[model samples]
Target: MINTRKKLITYLRKRDGIKPSLQATLVNIRCKLPDVVIFGGMVRDFGLGVRHFSSDIDMVTTASAEQIRHALAGLNPVMNKFGGFRFRENGRLFDIWSLQDTWAIREGHAQAKYLSDLCRTTFFNLDAVIFDVHALKVRARHGYDEDLQRRVLDINLEANPNPRQMAIRAVRMAIQKDLQLAPALVEYVLEQLYGTSLNLTYQSYVRQLHDHTGRTPESAFRFEPQLKIW
Candidate 1:
């Protein structure tokens, strides 16, 4: 596994646009909410050494939504149904989720336990990897770092797995990270797409395809580079 502290610092240093603002924001949040940790796409892309212009950052904290809102009062955060707060600063979006109010607890999949347990229950693939700002350490479930190094796409099937969402995200990540899906994983995603009746509309898929490829929806779906099953 990579040294989480060094890699995180390096990642932040590389982002000249948001580094100073992000550092200041993190310091302020940590001062008030000592248990908040950064995670999700930012850390994932950092680990993979992929550079992309991202406007949002995701974090989880032990503090309540109200506490977080109060702590970040200057930003004027708005609370959402998912028990998270969204705010913008310097043209960047910050999404902070209360650890006590995650969907896993509401859905009865897991209890509100340790940060490690919460990290394990996160989304499938490399997105589950988390960076604890306080400890300056990385928390990843089994095979997470290996998947990152290998550029393989696999889902955490045991923890409230949403195949449809995973399938879409997998395609996006594959394109973003220049990754290839494992044979079995590709087969599984295809099965999930063909077998289940997902609420995701055809128009959504068309939009996503168009976003990824500049071609018309018909041509995009027919020959999208990201969906090439390896």
Candidate 2:
């Protein structure tokens, strides 16, 4: 297995592709926001790869439904006008979705309790970070902290999806980010949750998605890369 720490460093190198300092700074300033966290793909990167990058990152903060709506009031002059937080600049999109801690916690824990084939995630795009205003600390939620409490909190939070659904979404995103190139991880998750392989149709769709989203032609064509044959 790849040393998780090494993979994390690699991801950091690639994540430099897009400068997120502005967003990071904004999040830092908005630390007072309740249960505020920088989650999604960026955060997922820490658990999965050493170097990764993504244009979009999702931020989840602990605020009342109303408070979240108010905090993200000014996403973009027009985006706000359109009643959404999706903004596109230079052909890339950024999204900010805030959820109350109650909602987030209702869904699941923020850290992984154990690294089983089911709960363990070994692929990501862009390292994810959490700026906890309450704690007054910015932590690498997915990196090689080597400490259980620090590294595994809860699985990524989702509004209306279960672990299986989230795993599929994560696999797709990882392919898009070029962080993982095999089906093993996906199968691992499926087995853990579903106790079987993905149905033919689902498998085909995943393959197609990977073909279009993965790093290279070969990587997409061959789910099992030479380096990570399983």
Candidate 3:
């Protein structure tokens, strides 16, 4: 578990290194995809004040499945430097789940099923948002998720970056051993992930959180560091 925790932190630090550029690239993709919705860790991290590069960029869109399929088709070859790419589209419901190693794609619905499904597929973390080309509004959706809100609040105290709360959320999720109860351990996980050197006040809060959660520090940060490209 300690080894897992260390690997997770290193992965996050690297992912944080790539977020801004990747975000801009996706925003550019929005010009082509239109009605694309992106939501995930990237969104959560930006909210928390952690300025770092992110690798896995997840997104949700209002467009139909066909539209999503088409957009992903375009992303191929062009985004090769970052890594490889793969995608899944459900035309019946107009949804998509795309992946490129550490990153993932979740579109169509915002329900627990889609979110949980995408969450289970990755190793590091994810960041997503929705872009409405028609309306020209690149909306931030994390403010609406209770779990995400709590995670962002906890991480932002130390790692919040400009408009990158989504990224922090992904990191928080990575620290969470159980998705269903993620909100319950946001404080403890963030402390274990970031330490008091980053935010002194948050130290006591993490201890209190451990008492409330009844989970050992090892449990809070136990994620196997596996980044499978497919």
Candidate 4:
């Protein structure tokens, strides 16, 4: 497991060939938002030893949306409702979101009195890791490395989870990483599939898969049987 921040950074640099432009952007964003961290898929893939040819990076900062926009003035950022700004650099899309903003938008989260509180709520799986840009460190909450190593999909029950989103993600991760959902998580997913209106429709799930991978839904679903989502 990648235990240190320095090792994680070096691994990413070597594995992703993180371009100079991307590094400069990270440095620039950090100048304005001192607490900015990179999170989500890029970090997960890195931990799992999976390499992507074109990865979309996700970042979160303690800075407000306006502050982030001012920090990234020349990037032509498109503001998103979720306290995020999206922009393209060297043909890759990068999303930067505000920590407080994301916390506010979600329901049932404890008041985020500290950054650590927000970080805990932001992640789903153990692989939902973060990279501290300023400190040059890779950090994961408890259970992160263990879950990654076990290839288990253990959902964060404390966090407000979207059932449909989780179901879709479970399938994608199962296919991409050959992971198995923990039995409890499997029950939760099935409950969400039948018991909740928040479950993602077949069409919506397919669309999401297409948007991320450009693969047809049929191809994506081919892995569903292997996932044993029954």
Alpha carbon lDDT at 28, candidate 2: 41
RMSD of 2: 10.3
lDDT of each: 0.66, 0.41, 0.37, 0.62
Best by lDDT: 1
Maximum-TM-score candidate: 1
Return the lDDT, model 3, position 20: 44
TM-score for each candidate, following the candidate numbering: 0.75, 0.42, 0.36, 0.73
Regions of candidate 2 where Cα sits further than 4 Å from its true position: 1-35, 46-52, 76-92, 97-104, 107-129, 132-136, 140-144, 147-164, 167-223, 226-230
lDDT of 1: 0.66
From the highest lDDT down, the ranking of the candidates is 1, 4, 2, 3
Off by over 4 Å in 4: 1-8, 11-21, 103-108, 158-161, 194-230
Backbone clashes under 3 angstroms, per model: 0, 22, 58, 1
| Local accuracy of candidate 2 as per-residue lDDT tens digits, 44-79 | 454444254545644555345455555545543123
Q: In model 3, which regions exceed 4 Å deviation? A: 1-24, 77-210, 213-230
Report residue 198 deviation for candidate 3 (angstroms).
Answer: 25
